[model samples]
Target: MTMTIAFAGTPTIDDAPGIDWREQAACRNHPEPNLWFPVGINDPCDDAKDICVNHCPVRETCGLVANRTRERHAVMAGFRCSDPDEFIDLRIWLGVENPARRTRTCRHCGVKFSTRHPRRRACPECRDLVPLEPVHRHIQHLRNVGKYTLRGIAAASGVSVGTVSLLAKGQSPYEGPYVSRAIAARLFAVTTEQEAKTA
Candidate 1:
């Protein structure tokens, strides 16, 4: 596997563009720098990958570094020198502190944000101006009416179960107008009636 990887066209430093290999090389050798990899190959969990991909800007470079070092365990850049028996025992491998904390960084705005709520992507500033799809709204209604699951709501609304889950989780941020109206007619009936009363 190592032989195959090494021969796979060193991917000229420039060929694999959009990432800084020189700077990363410097950081790799730097006396004090952040590490990227954190798991041993035989590690018992799968969640660390979330942190690696989330925080990594040049994830490919980090992976290459891990391979070059011939690390038997999954290592983030240099996040783990040796595999610890457990995650809590993990200490600073590179420069990152508290890898357990989930945070989001916008690629477009380069803004850093954190959230305690799940199913959220952009910060409030990015999300507030965006309109909600009607299909999503309908899914919410089914959930409120004791559906309690995406499959149940999808069955009732004739939408895909995956689509319903994405709507409920806020993962499907884009939708067509037809789906939007269907969602509104189903979920906002009570709210619309209340609006008519005030009107």
Candidate 2:
């Protein structure tokens, strides 16, 4: 029996001698290389599997090698095939499977619906009710009266510096269509607190 082991930072097969099967493996140089390992009967890392299935150039070759060698316990060609039967199933799943479109429950309306995009968490009905303009106006007011920096507004409002910068420039978070209620509430609370302190 011949065991082939490749280490991180090792030169790819194209750059080195011999035709290492791992040369075109997408798991190479991955931060969590061990995500390739199977947890029970399923591939533990969906992201890693997606990379191997979609991006890996040598997926078929790697799968063939793993199947022939009866390699169990580790992910090969994006499949967590522990046995020959599982390998066949993995092949079938890879060919036929389509990822289910993700959906999010609206935080405000208690309604669930499919979103056109992943970042759109709120339902369309509640999108107009988010009340971001007042929060934007209050943030500007704080900056003008209290001389608050972007970092200061972020600290006070419990959001990221980038978010505060966006609001300061009349932009939305992540350039998204809606502002989260938590952000508006926090900004309002901070503004009220500042007003109380001054009064």
Candidate 3:
């Protein structure tokens, strides 16, 4: 029996009658094949993706197949549709329903905006409004001059020992659920008082 893959706008049959469609994939020759299957959201895949998508001759076909099959993992045609909803959004942006239209609704503010990057969910306005990293020096001061241990800082300011450790080590103190401004202010006041007593 002959099998045909159907894309949203057009259908293309796999060339070798009985063979699987993936056998004809353009990314089959990649050096680090596992790089395509990134484990985390922040994992680096751009180098492999560039070869698989931009350099591949069958990128469009790959995208069509990926979208049709509702692929949840792996990059296809430079797009990583992590879920069915993301695939639908990709199709809409690809102009499956309307060829002339190419826009995506921002995940944050629900504003429609044009984007060449398929993975971009937020509009420029919302992207710019994202919070900047907190100043690490405030935490450093407590550790350096105030001589506060991680446990001591955690006890005094109610910030976690892990966060205090990161700050003391000159690492990202503001990553993830970090010390709040109120807690930081309290720590700053405590450090200032310590500084005054030692002076």
| Candidate number with greatest lDDT | 2
> Of the candidates numbered 1 and 2, which has the greater lDDT value?
2
Q: Is 2 or 3 the stronger prediction by lDDT?
A: 2
Going through the candidates in order, what is the number of backbone clashes in each?
15, 0, 0
Instruction: For residues 135-172, write the lDDT of model 3, one tens digit per residue.
Output: 36766666677776778877876555775566555554
Model 3: which ten-residue window has the lowest total lDDT?
A: 1-10
What TM-score number comes out for model 3? 0.44
- lDDT of model number 1: 0.42
Structural similarity to truth (TM-score) of each candidate: 0.23, 0.36, 0.44
Model 2 spans with C-alpha error above 4 angstroms: 1-17, 83-85, 90-199
Q: After superposition, how far is residue 114 of candidate 2 from its true place, in Å?
A: 26
- Model 2 over residues 10-108: C-alpha lDDT tens digits? 233232247775756777767676667644432245676798789998777666655555566667777666534446545455444234556788654
Q: What is the lDDT of residue 196 in candidate 3?
A: 72
Each model's lDDT: 0.42, 0.62, 0.57
Ranking by TM-score: 3, 2, 1
